[model samples]
Target: MKIATYNVNGVNGRLPVLLRWLDEAAPDIVCLQELKAPQEKFPEQAITDAGYNAIWHGQKSWNGVAILSRGLEIEEVMRGLPGDEEDTQSRYIEAKIAGLRVGCLYLPNGNPAPGPKLDYKMGWFERLKAHSAELLQLDEPVVLTGDYNVMPTELDVYKPERWVDDALFRPEVREAFHSLVAQGWTDAIRKLYPDQKIYTFWDYFRNAYGRDAGLRIDHFLLSPHLDKRLLAAGVNREVRGWEKTSDHAPVWIELTAGG
Candidate 1:
């Protein structure tokens, strides 16, 4: 089955573009980020009309995430990251679909480093690491899919030096990402297309999309215990051109059944 992720930016603003892609790509499952809408305000009719079942964790005008599957069953696992009872960012949600546990996230974009935002980003990542380790210990098929808002290596960013001082490219952020990956998780896209410059997101400013100035921040990291079923991975770049569409494109992967 095909599983995909897309940061729609705003569910209400880009609903049309998102629906068009859903019809064209027809992935078995899709995780969405940056809904920027509240739970009661989500456009339920549009998604239901597309023949998908979905669940969301949302707030207003900022971060949100959801999972949509075509007739596939999902068991709710978690809503937010651990380690902070008072934190209210709608950035994480986990669910189980057909025995595969999936963690959908929209990690913080801690811009303007050397500030409180950067500190929060680091602390959030630490919590993620701890929770991820627990998931790994479950020893089941687990896929961590999300817009991580991080570039772990120079190869993942188009202009590495230009982003050196940026939160996404800072040393600490990259190191934390490395620590997560080192725990026997395979970066599906990188593993599938090593040495190839493939990007899943581009900025809306200064012609970043048209000029091909993009970053490979979206990821599907599978635990080593679930790698046997690895099938295919790809980025649906065509959808990025839709009217009022998100800067981020759709990334997907397929896995074999009972491998």
Candidate 2:
């Protein structure tokens, strides 16, 4: 099965691009982030017409997440991450599809660090760590896939020194990512192409995409069982060049039917 993740930025505004990609890529399962729409505003019919069933958690003009499955029912697992009752952002959503437990997340950007935003980012990371530990004990095929908003290592960024002060590349953020992967979750893309300079996101400013100045922030972390099924992984870099497209391109992994 082919599983993919994309940060659509705004589902309504980019529906055409999304549909076109869906037709072209035809992934069996897709996780989308950054819906930027209210619950009532989601274009359910349009998505349904594209040959997929979906479940989404929408928030007004900000964070949101969804999972779409082609020719299959997506059983809702949960909405929103555990460990924070006061947190109301629609940034995390979980579902079961194709015998895998999938968690889609849009982690906080936390720009202009050394402040409250950074604190919240770190706090959220801790919560995710705690919950990830619990998921690890399940002994089932699991995939944590989404726009992580983190550069796991210098290898993931165009220029390591250039993002020294950036929240996404800060030591603490990378450390948090390390802590999660240390739990035996396999980063599918990195594991597939360890030495290649692969990237999934580029800034619109400074002609970053044209210059190939990008970062690998979106990811697919497979639990041990699922990792064994990973067959191929790559970034659809051309999607980022589409007209009115999002800053992020789609990242995907192909998995064998059974482990």
Candidate 3:
């Protein structure tokens, strides 16, 4: 089965491009981020017409996530990341489908570091770490996929030095990501293309895509049970070139049947 993650930027504005990609890629399951719409504003009918059943957590004008499954039952397990009852952003959604526990998240961007935003980002990371550890204890086939918003390593960035101090590439942020993967989860893309500079996102400014200046922020982290099932993975790079497309391209992975 194939699973993919895409940060749509603004789902409504990019609905056409999204539908087009869905038609072409035909992934069995998809995790979408950045819906930028309210709960009642999600385009459910349009997505349903594309032959997928979906469950989404949406917030107005920013941060939302959703999971879509093609012909499979999507049993929503959670709408928000656990451990933070006061947190209200719609940044996570988890579901059970095809015998797999799937988590879709949009980690906070945490820009203008050395401030409250960065503090919230780190706090959220801590919560994620706590929750992820619990998920691992379940010992099931699990895949946490989404626009993580952190580059994770120098190799994941186009120009290492240029992004050193940026929120997404800051040392602490990358360390947090590495720390997450260190908990026995396989970074699927890196596992397949160890040394390759594979990127999943490009900025809309400064001719980033045209110059191939990108970052591998979106990712899939698989639990031990599904590690050996990983077969193939890639970035649909051309999708970034589409008119009005998101800065992020679709990142996908193929897994063998029966993990």
**lDDT by candidate, in order shown:** 0.90, 0.94, 0.94
Q: Clash pairs of candidate 3?
A: none
RMSD per model, one decimal: 0.9, 0.7, 0.7
Q: Mark the 10 consecutive residues where model 2 has the least summed lDDT.
A: 222-231
Each model's total of backbone clashes: 0, 0, 0
Q: Which residue pairs in candidate 2 collide?
A: none
Model 1 C-alpha lDDT versus the unseen true structure: 0.90
Models 1 onward score TM values of 0.98, 0.99, 0.99
lDDT of 3: 0.94
lDDT per residue for candidate 3 within 1-259, as digits (tens), equals: 9999999999999999999999999999999999999999999999999999999999999999999999999999999988889999999999999999999999999988878888889888988988899999996899999988999888999989998778898889989998999998999999999999999998888999999999999999999999999999999999999999999999999999983
Q: On residues 1-259, what C-alpha lDDT tens digit does candidate 2 reach at each position?
A: 9999999999999999999999999999999999999999999999999999999999999999999999988999999999999999998999888789999999999888989999999999999989888889997899999999999999999989999999999999999999999998999998989989999999999999999999999999999998778899999999999999999999999999983
Q: Of the candidates numbered 1 and 2, which has the greater TM-score value?
A: 2
In terms of lDDT, which candidate is stronger, 1 or 2? 2
Order of the predicted models by lDDT, top scorer first: 2, 3, 1
Candidate 1 pairs with clashing backbones? none
